[model samples]
Target chain A: MVDGSARISQDPEPRKNNRVHPVLKLLYKKRWAYYFIAPATILFCIFTVIPVIRSFILAFQEFRLMGNVWVGLENFKYVLTDPVFHRAMRNTAFYTVVMVPQGVLKALILASILRNLPEAVQTFFRGAYYLPGVASAVVISMVWKWIYDPNFGLFNFILGTFGFGPYPWLTSPKTSLTSIMLMGILTAPGYYIILYLAAMKKIPRELYEVADIDGATPFAKWWNVTLPLLKPTTLYITITSIIGSFQIFTSAYVMTQGGPGYSTMTVVYLIYNTAFRDFEFGLASAQAIVLAAIIVFISVYNFRVFSTDVQY
Target chain B: MRRACWVLVLVLLIGSLAVSFGSIGAASKWTGTIQVWDFPRPAAAEEWELQAFKEFEELHPGVKIEYTKLTWAGGNEKLDVSVAAGQPPDICGSGLRLPYILQGALEPIDDFLTAEDLKDFHEETLNAVKLNGKYWAWPWYNTLYVMYLNADLFNERGVPLPENGEWTWDEFLSAMQKLTFDRDGDGKIDVYGFGFTFQPTYLQPFGFIYAEGGRVLDIDKNEFILDSPEAVVGIQRLCDMVWKHKCALPGAGGLTTTDVNNAFLNTRSIAAFVDTTGIISSFEAHNEKVEKGEIEGEKINLVTAQYPRGKNGQPIAAGPGVGSWAVFKQKDDAKREVVMELAKFITRGEGQKEVVPLIGVFPSCKSAGNVWAGNKNLEHIVPAVEYAVYPPMHPNWNKIDEKIMRELQLAVLNEKTIDAALKEAKRQIERLLEY
Candidate 1:
């Protein structure tokens, strides 16, 4: 069998001694493919990979004015016992629980509705929904801050019309976290909706037609065809949303400043305060690593649940 | 593929060329370009810089001043990064916080000033700029916290003002109770007697600890004395004002400078503990409303007094005033000479006379105070300045203040008992001192 395979390979390239080998020729023919791929890979390495590796190295060391000293596990130990770190972890967990499912489900529902609309109407709605994603986070946070102002906000004005008392949306410890989470939910979900809509549109019409011929009802067809086809997009969105939720910082930092007594202090905000405010770069790096590990674990779990060899 | 590589190369070449051009452009002689980093004041950076530069340019023609404005919130970090990067501005204005000086981030100006130049500034004001036996910064403006009362509220309640800018704790509480009222006749109270803030400096009246002759930190021993009897009494008095007397608002622990100022401006509260600078602006902004029949009681009369005297019978107020100036060491010799000259010019009697009114910042020089001696608007600041006690001058003051203030907030908000909070603060401060 080896002799026969070798003879077959030799027969296909009889004049190879005078020129480049066929394999080399094939690779050279596809040189543009490699060229096209190089830019994104280089960018990804520089921007994402390098920083990530640097952050990992920084986690085990003590950063001081003079130089960094390697004190393995010391920073991690400090992070575990630090009250501020604990508070940050608790706040981030609470925020994730409140924000992630709500964002994902709302996007899914909106995408489903949009999918049934006329093509032009769907396009307009998609663009309108995705507009907030294009806005600067600082501007969005500021606008939301004004809207949630207790003294003369639009929210308070609306409540006043209904004979309800004004709520301290961003001030009171009781309502501040929820109010910010609501902003997060509203500002996000739009991009995910657009993604899901595109994914749904890509589902072959023949699948639904076949289901219909098999006497599948609208709901049945959607359950058997549309939902299954959208699983990969849903998985992607879920992992991203989880990671995004874990790193929620700008809104809380700008609006409430983790105040009314640490009610809105997310893990990333704490990391920022530790590194920049207190200049405890080592502790901040450790906290960041812990955060990253949690994200990786959740992503892996999501992949296991969503992607499998047993395809429907 | 070849075209793409060429494009990438061209882009990189252009980037490098642009960078080189920028470096060459910046390499030019000073040519009147005075780089300045100013923190947020009511006056815009450009407006203030232009005014100062225009005057300087007239004196020394063919020079331009470049000004960069930094926000107060992150100004220190930005300044630190610039210094670390070895590209700090020729001049920087910062709060008279000690860490910057201790860290050698600022230049010492002792060599620049002669004995005669030094003699013009108040000794205490001079002390504020000194760190480790060297003058690290020049004192530009000073402000002290003072109690401002709404005269209309005091008159209506028949509560007499302090006899001589001094009142005991009991008398202060009695006045606060009488002033606090439910205007709508509802069971719930709409107005608070005192708009007390839970800031570190606001706790100054409890200066009984220092008056009782207790130190904030034993610099020699490097330990905190915050849990001392004097500190306990001061802290207890603050808590009593909130929980027992009910004179202070419940959310006073979280009150911001803007919130307290708003309360005073909107007539939502009777009294406010604020800085002299804020009072100046408040009066200026509402002077017309006071003249008209707009504010309640047909003419709002605002009066200032010293913080209520502690039980020791000696009135003590926390006077932590921050000054701005140009440091000589931070700049090259030529830049240093110019900065020193500019500093002298600005802090001179003439500069003070020109800038103080526009900025509303009190002058650091005694001569400048004389300029505003008879002005009614600036009259309130005079008494506060006279008796203002400076906060402890330590390199770690920022850390100390943050820990102390956090504890004070907890104690005031009843989140922690006074003893526990004070102990925790002392422990934290001790840790800070070691660093």
Candidate 2:
């Protein structure tokens, strides 16, 4: 943080008889930067910032077209007491508890395997894994629905050929939540894999060479050198994966539709149903605010747990 | 001076009379663009859908109707959002007792329509439109969900058809067991006897529930009664078909309407299912294609039947929903009147005649009387509309429908007991109606 005066300009003196005001000079210096940022800034404020602010206000009111009545804490109280909301919270928490670790591990393993491959092979594999991510979540969910179908799905077909019994992957309430989380864990977290691979490249070769000279095997070297160095990247992936798992919706919506009971319901999906399906916008806003608060608290806790000081 | 005063008095008298006539003219004359939204489904909004707009423009010259199209997926939500933003279309089909009516976003049809005008529509449609002793929308069309059987499949399995398309639960189950058989020597079953979807407001499957004399809401529309013993028996029968009998498709509760429809028609795996009149229309359309060698599929000998009866002697099904046009509340009295006229013109005989062929729905108005005289597919299905039970009128009914349908799915999946499922649904619905 620079002081206010230092931020204006590094130059202390102006040209003799310069007509421009100090403020105008400062503004003119950053004119192109302002011009470049204005469109994005304005649009961000209009679409994202304004809606978020309005939703926050809406969280405190009974939303009505004619007149929105101030009913402070009422919607929050309703959400707290609602059994469905409690179920959704439990589902979301369970999904995160299971999904976050598996997602990070999947990405880490894939990235590690790809890191040692030939450049051409690695590129092809990366693209292959990322291909599914390129398609919309709705489309992927539809494909997964076919794959999980008990009667005619690919998974059941394979199992049937071996004379193993068919199990309902998404239909039964017992497996619906697990099925949803498995989708998240299996959907190729390509973005995180790329991040890990990039971070792995930055790890110093000297550390691995030292481990090798100390009679360490490849796996031991990886554990001592590669693993410890990727802490920052792992933390990034973990926090993001946790957030994504909590917000899992499209797969659940397109597949089980939060059903076979409330087994597959997530907080975000429930919020959507409460607002759009039930037309309880105030309650929905309140639920969303609560979710945001939860995310912030979790993110802070994650930072405290995962922060690292390894600079090399 | 006297001549000058007389001249001024004559001018003043003429001016006052002119002003009074002008006010009357302004009150009667309506102009400007009436923002109209089309039916949500694009397929439903064929060329003939614009007939009402053209007619309105022809009758009231200089008045423009700005038409907008909405998709079925989020159309109602769009209308609700528009209303909240104070820019709802002048006319739309927001249903009779939905949020638009509950929130006072639409005008009551009774205000603009006379008793004589109401006479053209069937009493069933009118019943659907009436909410709180006031009609909320113009009755446009009627729908009756019926159980459709693949008669060819029945014949192949040597299963006897129900007597007069009416059968008790035992008879239906026995027939279903015969129809469900493995074609190949493989141990796995090849064809299932039944399939149905459990989507929100998808009421076709609920026909079976009503057969057990199970009702969702009371007359006052305030409580959930779906957890009754009869209702439990009703849902249990469907569940038994899946697990105990194994005569139904696995994971049927998660199947879509399209999935079941395709299985009944194209895939030809499932022998039977319950669906709206549109399925019969679709069957006819597909058979036409098959005849022309346009597509290849199994022969479709569509058989329409009442939902199988349970403890209740008579068959019961859900229907009697009047898909109706409604006018949004307008500040200008003249504009509102014109909008009402447009709504009426769009829903009456000529408009019904023009769109029914494209949409394949039975018209609610008697004046559009028997548009299905030559259309054999829909003609036979019309009589079943009499056996229809209207869905309960309530604002939270959509959410309640979802809760009940989810419970139905859970029961069918054998994830929960039928009693537990319906009770959970009841608990959820009671929570929705807590206010």
Candidate 3:
């Protein structure tokens, strides 16, 4: 492999004469590296990248089995003007605004507590918290649906015991979207916790020692030393978490069905119904592009506010 | 020696070519895979569900049916995606919704459904299968959306059964009031007399909406007419049961069929609810469990009743009124014929007689003729099919349904007045219909 590649790369006459493309020459020089990742890259292109490109194209075409008709901006115009789509956008924005912070905070609290525990205890607790992420979201939603049931649910039963009124957790328009948001905050913050844990372990132990010598309390030490150092990781988790929040579907689809009104309908659920339920694939694709653009805008805003650079 | 070898090779080659041409000369029967996606019917009908697949395979060697099990909750999306992917099953038991028709994905069965076979089908059943006067599916069974009353609850409350399973709006309201009580004298009401789901995608509320002289749409003119006063009063009457009369369960406006049914079965707190004949199988199963002592309770004495009369003066039933089978478009005519044959083998002749009764639904074919002739549970609703109605055959039915139900839900929850909700729904639907 080295003999063949070295011969090609070392021969600079073709490159100097502009016979070989610069990108191709560079790829040829790194042929072994390319070969190692080629399979995965090909698969990713086929499954993810191509479909995304096609979805963008589909946004401007009326989809049909036999053939698709070009509809220009009609699909985008319809989705923007539709009241239901507006509701979905508002609901998605709410999820992003509310759940993302709660999620980051919960993970921070969890990782901070667990890192101080004995290794054995830490391992056990981490595994326990991570168990839910391994389970199907659809299955989790079904369990939550029962917990939120108005008359016979666990929440109502608990309230009844306290001589409080039964709340329509998922059934009322006022509370339905909040119930869905509450689920996001309440579920085990396994993924984020793991990320925070790994980031926390890399902080120099001497930073804490210096803080202790300065007579700083544990809270002050954490606030001054741990959190600022974890900013890069926090920024990463926050961006990803916001993306996840915007795409909330399985739970809403299973629990309230975006109902009582269009209260709980999120952008992804609307896209799904438009494409699959109503067969308006072009409109669904347009809605999806709008959702992607919103996520991109928010992600950029998050970076401007949270991203940090540290030599360490 | 070389000449002899060449002659021998030529003789063998000619023999092979002659045999190949001989086989190609005869008309060959087509055989391959016939794909099917179906929801779980009653476990009682499991045998019937697989029976046609088995018989079709046996009758035509090399023909195999690949079956995929689908859940009722998720099946619509699955079917839609499959159709959009141009990979729908050759045989599926989805209703003749207009979306598939407009996609030109379904193969109309008119050519295969003969005139003799046509005579046996109910006109309503035929109409349900037809759009633009072309029949698109083979009707297997028709289900009526009627009220199911727990007779035990009725008796314990000393409320008489609807006389002849018929009640006017006043009588219905009075019975609901009498039956609802705080059983343990707790501050909270223990059981509701009547409960109805107002979710979109379900036609449970439609029976009442159309109970009076209200029709959802005039299909001939293609208009959204629910804002008409007749429909408003009909919807208002239901809203009153939840808000004014307080005879229905809490969360009735947004609850699911499963929610209300579970409340009735497990809590024993719901006396009456509305559903299609498909639910009869579920009730029968629950009864079986009760008899076996696996469940704790008296066997729910399920009695079928019609929705109370509105100003229309006759009981009304409405829903996705009929369940039928359609063959999706196929690449080969011979395979299409085979798929149509399988559809016929499942719905008509002996097929309807065997499958329809096991599932406890009324047959679409008149010749299948009262399979539940003496069953007390079906005594009233079996005849109520005559009054059954369905949604207008709109291509945008799902969206239209969503809007209408959202408005109705707001009305039922007292978030909006019935008139306002209907007017808003009509205003939105007119624009959608224009599209």
Candidate 4:
């Protein structure tokens, strides 16, 4: 890193503006770069940053068509006591807890297997695995809804062929959350696989060869060399999967509508229902802020745990 | 130069002549667009809407109408966002409840109509859209829930049907239990006596509650009385039908209105179901299929009956599914006038005749009823108009409805006791009322 900085310092063309103020000279030198990024920065601020800030403000106010009024802690009080909110939080936690580790482990295994395959075969399988991720969540939910239909779904039909009776895959409360979790585990691991595969490729072949020279088995080499080196990638995948699972909404909404008695209700789905369906924007914003805080806390904790000795 | 100027004048004159000749009756004095957000209807069902738009646009040449069709699935959410962002459409054709909930955001249309013109609408239909003795919207048609019975199943089981299209809840329960049986003696019940989803429409339990003289809100006192004895009785009956009797098909807790409708209409697995008058179209199509030898079973003889009477002995009163065209409070008076003009045009004689039939709803206009007189389906719902109950009007009624429905679902699913569910619902509704 120091040698790279020294090489850039030796570039004579960039050092010619020594008379101007240092900050001004630096700004001038990067003017075209700033200009190139201005559109994206402006768009991000307008769409994302503004709404996020506004939501934080809204969390402390009451929304009305005529005007908004400040109502600090009131919305949070209501949300905290809300029975549906409690159910949503519990359901969301269950989904995240069950889905994240399952997704990360599945992706890691698949990526490890793909790493040993021929380049062409790896590419083919990578595309195949990533294909479903390209489909919109709504579309995927709709297709899964059909597959989970109690009477005439593909799952029930296959079950019937084995002399077992039809099963209500999504309709029954006992199975609804499990069915949705299965979908989350399936849909979430594809992108993680690609990331893990890229990270695996970056690991030096010398490490594995050193293990091989030490008379290690293939599994031992993978465990002692490849797995240890993939720590940063694994941490990234786990944190992201946890966040994604916590926001499970589309499947529950499109398929069950948080129904069979709110068995599949997640925090994000509850937020949508409270905000849009019930027209309680302040309460919704408070719920979202609480959710964001919970996510941040969990993610930070995960970073401390999984990222303790991450090399690279 | 004089010759060239004369040639240009000749060209201009020809162009003027062409414009005047081509746009004979297409002259429109009004200019600007009227944005509309409407609940999604089948594209084929909007033939009259399309025709009216064409006629309106032709007569008002410079005027443009930008129509947005919103699906019922997420339509209320879309409207909530639009209204929150202060960009609601110039006109909306949603239910009576939503526009009323929007309060000052809607323009009262009483000023746009004369007493003589207003008298053309059914009083019950008008009452649904009126708040503070002023009309917020002009009605297009009325939708009411009525029981559709399978006469074949009733006769086959030798179970007597409701007399005079009316029966008490006791009689209704007795009939349903008798109608349910194990065919082929296989010990599995092949036929369900009734089918209905527990979705929170003001169709079933609310209808039953109203029949018993109980209500969700006392408009005068502004209090939620959902846990009243009469309301509890109505909800208990519904819950018992699922949890205790099991007369309905199992897993009805998850069925949509369409799912139940299909089970009753096409599959014949369900003996009866209560739904909107629009199910007449499905019944007619089924009858057509039977005539064409496409279906081999004994023909389904569909009969429309009144919803069962509650303890007070009055027939169930369904909330009027009044499809109303509400005008938003626009800044421009000219735009408001155009919106009112278009609304009046649609609710009146010729326009009403064209639209009401496609909608499969009973006409709101007294004169428009004549256009559907010969139709049997329209005749069935005509009696329901008198029995149509207006839902409690409040700006927070939608939220109240959601809470009530969610709790009712929990009760029906055995997630909560009937008393617990209704109590929680009442608490939530009271809190909303306080707001």
Q: Write the per-residue lDDT of candidate 4 for residues B240-290, one digit (tens) a residue.
A: 777788787665666556667767766677788877777687777777888
lDDT of 3 by residue, B148-264 (tens): 898888899899999778888899889999888898886788889887877878888788778777887776677888878788777888888888899998887767777888888
For candidate 4, the lDDT comes to 0.77
lDDT by residue (A1-312, candidate 1, tens digit) is 579668767876666454687788887899999899999999999999998898888899976543568999999998897765787788888889878888888998888888989999999998899888898888998888778766446897788788885676865666778898888776646789988988888888999889988999988887778888888887888889889989999987777666555667789988887787666688789999999889999899889977884243
Candidate 4: Cα lDDT at B357: 72
Please provide, for model 4 over A1-312, each residue's C-alpha lDDT reduced to its tens digit, 9 standing for 90 to 100: 469679867877765555579898788899999999999999999999999999999999987765678999999999899888999999999888888888888999999999899999999999989988898989998888767766556787788778786776776677888988777765646788899999999999888888878999999988888899999998888888788888888888887778776788889988997787666789999999999999999999999998889987
Best by lDDT: 3
List CA RMSD, all candidates: 13.8, 7.0, 9.9, 9.8
Better of 2 and 3 by lDDT: 3
Return the candidate ranking by lDDT, descending: 3, 2, 4, 1
What is the C-alpha lDDT profile of model 2 across A8-108, one tens digit per residue? Answer: 57757755646678888888899999999999999999999999999999999987765588999999998899887898999999888988888799999
Report, for all candidates in order, the number of backbone clashes. Answer: 2, 0, 0, 2
**Candidate 3 vs 4: which has more DockQ:** 3
DockQ of each: 0.07, 0.42, 0.31, 0.19
TM-score of chain A of each: 0.85, 0.88, 0.91, 0.90
TM-score of each: 0.72, 0.86, 0.83, 0.78
Clashing pairs in 2: none
Q: Mind giving the per-residue lDDT tens digits that candidate 1 earns over B1-435? A: 999999999999999999999877655524457777778766543366568767876665456667788887778777767665656677776633454554555677887788876877766577667655777777776655666777778887788987645676678778888877887783446567777555534443344344444456655466687777866776677678778988875555545445566666674564545455555666755777667746643345766666666655665555556566755244457566777666666567567666666666556766775555666545544544534455656766755775676566667767779788778887766656765
Question: Top model by DockQ, which number?
Answer: 2
